[model samples]
Target: MRSFFKIQFLFLILIFISARLYSQEAENEKPFEAPYLFGSDTLIELSITTNIKELIRDTGKKSKYHQARLSYQLGDSVVSMLVQLKTRGHYRKNKNVCAFPPLRIKFDKASSSYTLFHDQDKLKIVGHCRNNNSRFQQMIFQEYLIYKAYQILTPEGFSVRLARITYKDSAKEVKNLEEYVFFIEDFEKMAKRNGKIPIYKDRIHQNNTMIYEVTRMAVFQFMVGNTDWGVPTLHNIKMIAKTPTSRPVPVPYDFDWASLVNAPYAVPNEKLDIESIHERLYRGYRRTPEELEFVFKEFRMKKESFYSLYQNSDLLTEKEIKRVINYFDEFYDIINNPKLVKRYFIDNSRQVRYK
Candidate 1:
């Protein structure tokens, strides 16, 4: 009787331990909830105490986030809140074009995503700056459309919210400008939506990356005629891993300098052997025929929906639409032709990802 009782007690202890571990696992694997953030046309008003020019030109300084007040009139009520701002982007900073420098905004401790301001530790805001040039403004708008295209392709991507921001210079009355700007989905939030955690490991090989995600990314990059990204450099790319042991997936961004947008300042890398941003190059590794066939079939399925996106774009002018569509047409033409795909994407595929 003593031996039987002792065995029963051990079994009960094992059951208790198993239950505790299962509870923890269930919490971690809970279904991801997505926040339906952003409006089609949200009018935002902002007031900053810092000198707008100095704050924007503070490219080298990264010590502190400048404080500011943000307010938007909701019906009859004024929703005013405290916020912090920081300068963003590298190329635009060096180009002396004050018109389009990107920025990062953070909500005050008092503010939460549920509050009128929405929840975010920091939000990536791509500004429409640079002498208030209409062309540049058009370019910014087109880039936002690109983000939308990615979203349609996969739910596991960044979503952009358009905001017409009005800035007031605290020191200089005439230094303010009302321009079209857009903010992107926060990275932490994106990971949650995908039921995964963000992986910051850079310079990882494409082979080590998720096949579906990397192939889609590579095909999409080709469609955009962009040669600016690579797996090793982590340039214009982000990765997320489902778990520590899961293979990472690639998420690409920063389309302002890509071929399809073709901003005046955008240039192709000389090492790419292309003189124009309009040139398309296959930068992804050459996979087996079976692997590439699957990817190509995916793109073929996405072709009509992809073109439809550009056709109904909200911000692109007729001419801008034509130019972008034509560029895509070139890519589709290549992918449609077996001979061309072999010569361009497969035959021309880089054997080495780094080189």
Candidate 2:
């Protein structure tokens, strides 16, 4: 009788164990939709549908998120990825300006951060701000090119893909329109690539971190005529660090407001002396002359390589190309000059104010 009872208990335990194993297996079998993103220069074409008028109409409230279908070419066949779409950006709220509002695409975080397949990680799509004029279209492309230029400077920067996005009215209320936009790599993926983790700690990056890389990023921002970032407030920048001991790296985005892209809304900060975003002010903290010189040398070596990107980019027409080159020429003039370094860096460098 004792043996029979013991055998019965063992049997019950095995049954319970088997049931648990089956449950775990079932969960694993469920489809984990993720995009298989790869390296290619191929321009991706995607069709996205959302109720634009409704989103714009409901200004004071949270716009309802919509299910959007994003289709792209893969190998020999077309593929589709499911994304949650919503209107995004600060300037869109202003009544007088009808700039094309940006979009925020949300993906299922359970899967990969890439957007190539079924993944639903968060990504921003930059498109025309208003009127959809030819010049606005070019501004969008200029922003795209600016991102490409940053990519040439560092692997730490966001990877952007030129996308020709077609906007279809889901309610069929607005006419179907297409615009040039770009997709940014997920921040998580970018940090993982460099063996770092994204951090949101509200401390200045230069306070207790490596100086060279921080200086490099600072100079790059100055080169692009951008002063629209602050590390402490986490405005227009993302920070990543491999360890607590290492300095955080900056991942910058939102260039439509940048002086280099020079959108209509772009303006210089009131606190800065310059009236133009085109004016370069070294926002970097003051360093020793030797230290600053080292940063200059690094930039000087890569200046040619960076300029070469604009020459190679076929997206801009001959006239547009010249305009772009001339804009950068103004920046190069400052960095290329030693006297300007004293005027911009030594005299203008901030210590505790920026931090």
Candidate 3:
């Protein structure tokens, strides 16, 4: 009886150790916990320290990355990480054109785990063009607002987080420079989130696109008074599809030329034959009245939410807000009037499909 009791006690001790070992192994195999950076619309503040002069001037070469230190607040702690940044854009990358060009930041994904940027790899940072120009800064914020407005319209839109950035230049006397900028969500991240894959083929016709998405994109572009995009060229737009045979869904970005931002350098496409960027044009293909009205109703339903995006913000001046609201009012008027809607959307719409 004593031997049997001793064996039972030893077996129970072994089971206890095995259970603990198994629990620890399971814990080690747990998936990474990622924090959602764009989960809210609240303003974010960030700091980036680097050689500012070299970064701004390094655009002359084909591709060069400058080491930068990025820091941001998370709860009571400030998290800092090493990042590689380089100038990104076609015209804006030119130093003569834009004093401060936009940046593409690459984060160390392995080290970024369990932080605000856990799953983040590369993110585009839209910065104010001219360093000291306040109007340009406002335009940057305006572009951010445009992204926010798009978010209100559809879940397919790219998520953006506006940030007040303080750039610390290590090489110059101007040690600190504050500016308004925003970070665009990674394209692959967004595509995966929507259970889709990004496609890179250009010259595709709009007729090959998802009708509802393409139609909404057209109306939204018209509302923003922007004609700097097209599906044929994939200019200022991205394509994503659920499957190989699925119609590509259009995702628009780069709103710096959008009338809502109205950057000083922005001009209407000469081919568009428009006097100014503010002049609205519907570049989308013609859709049935039923299809158009369905999209129109969606815009009507979300009008107030769109208005509130600018109204509730403290970034834009009273004058700026009023100007934007007035611009929106004009769009609403055009969409509401049957004659204007028919003329702009139905009658004047594109007839020839892209080859």
Candidate 4:
């Protein structure tokens, strides 16, 4: 009897160990929906039926989400689901500036299975600001490419999937609206993919940020001629870290104002002292010469890939492509030359420390 009881005890222990190991494996597995949604480079075709006029007129009361129907094609079938959407973002949400504001989409997780949106809860959508204007559409495409460029620079960045969407108003008589839009990956999903926790507080200083990552972010912003982001204020940037005690990494977004995109509405901040967005400014924290060199080398290694983004595109016109490449040529010239690097990067870098 004693031996039998001892065997039972060992059996229970074995079962417990197996359960724990299985749980760990499940935790480590990749999210089931991301691969289907973001794995392919091809643009996704999607349709949304909602009250378009009402959505755009929202006045930031943090009002209720407007009901909508989202549909996309898969193989031989069309998948449709009920979704909740609302106008999001400050500048884009302004009716005077943008006819169509950016959107925040919430999905029904229980019913989101077996489709591209499987296991997805919420996702941000960036669309063209103005309707009936091809120039605005082209600007959006350029912004999407900027997101792609950052993704190439770091795995710790957000992943964006471009889509061509047709907006249909159910209640109004407006014509069908077609535009190029892109879906930004969920924040929690990005942090989990990078094995980090998303930091919500904006008080963390750049000195506490990871040296190599922050330096890379700063240099990339300078290359793109963006002076719009700040780490401490969390202005147009997101933060993440391995743990609460670990140094954070800045993830930048919203580049419609970057000189690379050159949207008409984009202008330099009055306090920045720059006359125009065309002028480049280095806003990153000061780094050691060795650290700056290390970050510069990474950009140098990826130069060809960056150029190929514009050279091998089917979206932009040849004229626009040439213009963009020429703009970046100036950036490459500065990074490659020692004297120019010091003038723009070292001497022009931000001297104030954000506490």
lDDT of 3 by residue, 155-207 (tens): 78799988888999877656698988889998888888889999888888998
lDDT of each: 0.77, 0.74, 0.88, 0.85
TM-score of 2: 0.82
Off by over 4 Å in 1: 1-35, 38-50, 61-63, 95-100, 353-355
Clashing pairs in 3: none
Top lDDT model: 3
- Which candidate's TM-score is highest? 3
Q: Where in model 2 is the C-alpha error above 4 Å?
A: 1-38, 58-61, 73-77, 108-115, 118-120, 353-355
- lDDT (tens digit, per residue) of candidate 1 on 1-355: 9999999999999999999999999999986553355534344454434556666766764625777777766678766777887887777766465544678888875654444445567888887767578887887888888887787678777777887777877677456677888888888788878899988887789878997778878888888877788776789888878997799888888898787777888888878867887777878888777787788787788878888988977778899999988888888788778788888778888786354
Please write out the lDDT profile of model 4 over residues 6-59, one tens digit for every residue: 999999999999999999999989565344676777889999999988877874
CA lDDT, candidate 3, residue 152: 90
Model 4 — TM-score against the truth?
Answer: 0.88
Under the 3 Å rule for N, CA and C atoms, how many clashes does model 1 have? 6
Steric clash pairs (candidate 4)? none
Error of 4 at 7 (Å): 33
TM-score of each: 0.84, 0.82, 0.89, 0.88
Q: What lDDT is reached at residue 27 by model 1?
A: 97
Stretches of model 3 off by over 4 angstroms after superposition: 1-32, 353-355
